[model samples]
Target chain A: MITCDMAVSIDGYVAGPNQRADAPFGDGVGDSLHQWMFEAAEENAAEIAAITDAGAFVMGRNMFGPGRGEWDLDWTGWWGPEPPYHAPVFVLTHHERSPVQMEGGTTFHFVTGGIEEAVTRARAAAGERDVSIAGGAATVNQALAAGLVDELRLHVAPVLLGQGERLFDGVGRTELTPAGVRQTALVTHLRYTLSRTAG
Target chain B: MITCDMAVSIDGYVAGPNQRADAPFGDGVGDSLHQWMFEAAEENAAEIAAITDAGAFVMGRNMFGPGRGEWDLDWTGWWGPEPPYHAPVFVLTHHERSPVQMEGGTTFHFVTGGIEEAVTRARAAAGERDVSIAGGAATVNQALAAGLVDELRLHVAPVLLGQGERLFDGVGRTELTPAGVRQTALVTHLRYTLSRTAG
Candidate 1:
């Protein structure tokens, strides 16, 4: 099963505006969205573990790094030499670059083909385990519009970032069924199953 | 105290598009947002009661009816003779109309002076009881932008209305702290307190 986990503000922003190399998730966003994951780590351990438990991960180029356009070969992502994924990670981008092997088992493979191609490659690498779509609004929106996602896990923080990258903006009219819900003081974890599947 | 209760879809849309006299909440949103309130009345009894517990209510013109421009003197709102709100109700509109008195002490008072004026009138009528901002997005956004709300009670339904009237749109950058949370099978009740107050 394909699943995605996202941290969003109450106003539907995944990340605030003015995202630069200094502020990865954007200017005002900071780590506010993921405060529950860190501040209440013990309580949210299962959800935290689930985020990186997938065999392979697919992510957007912007999520991989803040650099746009041409490949910045020097920048090896925000994560250190040993990234958290510890699995094959497919990054969606327009420009192609050689796979960057990291410590542990994580390997960053750039996919120039598109979201479909990246997911396809990630699925192949995933084998028996699930292929997780690691996002930055754009990639998730694309996957959602394509009906590639089976489950959507949203961690809605209680703050509002008036303007930023919004979710479901151009995904068209979609329907979801509630699968699960859990809440903490800082965030509400809402899980949804897509009513329509990729045919 | 001022409080607002809104039924929002998972995607943040308060109501869907093509809102007509027949479809008050627009197409594809026919009572889905309030399904939990009806289907699980016993479970959500407290929330249901809290919604109409306010002494006075303020709402936007669109939420009152589908008519535009001049007031339809014949129309008396969606509810019949005796509405659920058995108190003074303030309707925000550009076109002015005389107060319409109904059964059960419910009165529809039109306010052409804008959201502040409507809310001010509702607050006055409320006396000691909390004044409720009965919404249809635009008015809610206006109130939120103005920081007139003291508390916000959001009933997030587990469905996605791809397109429609959305909440928190153009409200500028705002912040909310989580105050309460409750979840049932069909909906999640999230209550938040605004960090910024109306001065």
Candidate 2:
């Protein structure tokens, strides 16, 4: 089973122009949706490190860089000196690139084969633990539509962009079953068990 | 002082089709983003009532309406019989209509003279309590741009809406200061004090 954990803006934007190419999650306000992740970093570290529940992570290339923006040679790691993901991370991209290594036992592997292929590798790397699909937007939707996700936890922010990007922008009718919910210190976490149930 | 409270889709859209006169909360699932507000109705009723130190509410006509697409004439009072908003509410619209009095001291008044005029009327009616502009998008932007809103407490949802009516579409550049942040059982409340800080 794969679970996708993401933090977003009230308006649905993950990160804005203010975000840095090197440290994508820069010192900006608002979109600090994932600040909870950082806050719970150590607490969840046991669960994350044990790999008893989850294994590898999958992300899109766009999330790594800013899509078509100019490249910054030194702008590889989004997280600071110690990136959070302590396991193997497979990023889907078009342009071939070398895998980058960072602190906290995390490595960025750029995969171009396909999403399924990347998932396959991720599962293999994950071993007994589940594979987590951590992403920006396009990647998650693709996995969701392909029925590749088992669990999805979403934190609905209280902000409204009134514009920007959308995740379910172009999807047909779908129904989600709520598995459980968690009210964090700064988030309303809604965990859903996705299934192709025709209601 | 006036404040706008809203829940919009990750696509920047507030309501979908507008034809579904019955439920104008945006796309079908878009209404999912409103789970907290609805739940807050049940759990936080006493708390909301206690802290609702506001004079009246200001919403767009679209929020109150005859809906957009199918005109089934279903008045959408998502908040149940006795609305939580016991105070008077002013709806912004171009058409004229009679006022509606409902349970729990809620009176729905329609205003057409424009946002400023509506604010003037609401502020005068509010006395000491703040004027809350609970909206559907266009209304919030209007009040924010007009420099009439004194505070904005946005509940950023976790969903991403690729498109829809955005809250900050043309808000331009305005300075706002985040005054406080609090987390409840279902939402992360960010209270921002709006100010014309820079001249």
Candidate 3:
């Protein structure tokens, strides 16, 4: 299955504007968006575990690093030497680069084609398990528009970021069937499966 | 206390686009946005009771009728002879009109001043009970932007309305402290208290 787990504000922003090397998620958002994953880890244990349980991961170039246009060989990723994904990770970028092997069996492969190419490569690497779309808004929106995602998991925060990257803005009309819902003081975790039937 | 109970789609739309006299919530939305209130009445008994528990209600002119500019004296409301609001309802409008008393002790009073004036009148009519901001997205957004709301109860359905009357788009930055959360198969109920801190 192709799945995506994303965190969004009450105003529908995934990350606030003016993202930089210092502030990855952008200016106002910062760490508050994912604070539930850290501060309320115990309450969100199941969701946290499910986040990285996929076999292969696919992410956009912006999610991979802060640089643009050319490749930044020095910059590995937001995560440290040993990345969270212990499997292969396909990054969608315009520039192509050689695969970089990390400490804990994690390999970063650059795909120059597009979202579809990246997902295809990730699915091949996934083998038996599912492929996760590790997003930065643009990539997830593209995947949803192309009908690549089967399941969607949303962690909705209570704050409203006025100006930022929004989710589900340009993906067109889509139908979702509720799979499950869990809530805590910090965030509300909602899971849904994309409906294939057209009305 | 000034409170609001709003039903929104997963994409943050309170109601779909192209609202009319026949299709109240717009084209595709129809009664789907409020299907939970009727279908899951048993599971959401507490929330259902809390919704109409308010003594007085405030709403936008659009929620009152489909006509614009001049007063539609012939039309009363979408509801039948006896409206749901048993007390007084202050409707914000640009035109002036006399109060229309309905069955079951409900009275629709037109307020030409604005949202603040309407809210003030509703509060006065409420007496000891809480005032509710009965909405159609525009009014709720106005109340939230003006910081007139004390609590917000959101019933989020698992559907995506691509275009419509969106909530919190131009409300600027706001902070909400999560008070409670409840979930059913049809909808997820989230309650939040507006935070007063500047930071």
lDDT tens digits, residue span A1-199, model 1: 7889999999899988888888888877878898998898888888889999999999999999987889879988889999999999999999879999999999999999899998899999999999899998999999999999999999888888888899887887676777877777778888888864672
- Give lDDT per model, in order: 0.89, 0.63, 0.88
What TM-score would you report for chain A in candidate 2? 0.77
Cα deviation of A172, candidate 1, in Å: 2.0
* C-alpha lDDT of residue A155 in model 3: 92
TM-scores across all candidates? 0.94, 0.66, 0.95
**Which candidate, 1 or 2, would have the higher DockQ against the true structure?**
1
By DockQ, the better pick of 2 and 3 is: 3
State which candidate has the highest lDDT. Answer: 1
Better of 1 and 3 by TM-score: 3
Higher lDDT: candidate 1 or 3? 1
Model 1 residue A186 CA deviation in Å? 2.0
Per-residue CA lDDT of model 2 for A110-193, tens digit only, reads 888877888989999989988888876678877876778777766644343433445554543444555554444444455666
- What DockQ was computed for model 2? 0.16
Q: Rank the candidates by DockQ, best first.
A: 3, 1, 2
lDDT score, candidate 2: 0.63
- DockQ head-to-head 1 vs 3, winner: 3
List candidate 3 segments past 4 Å from native. A196-199, B196-199
Q: Just chain B of model 1: what TM-score?
A: 0.97
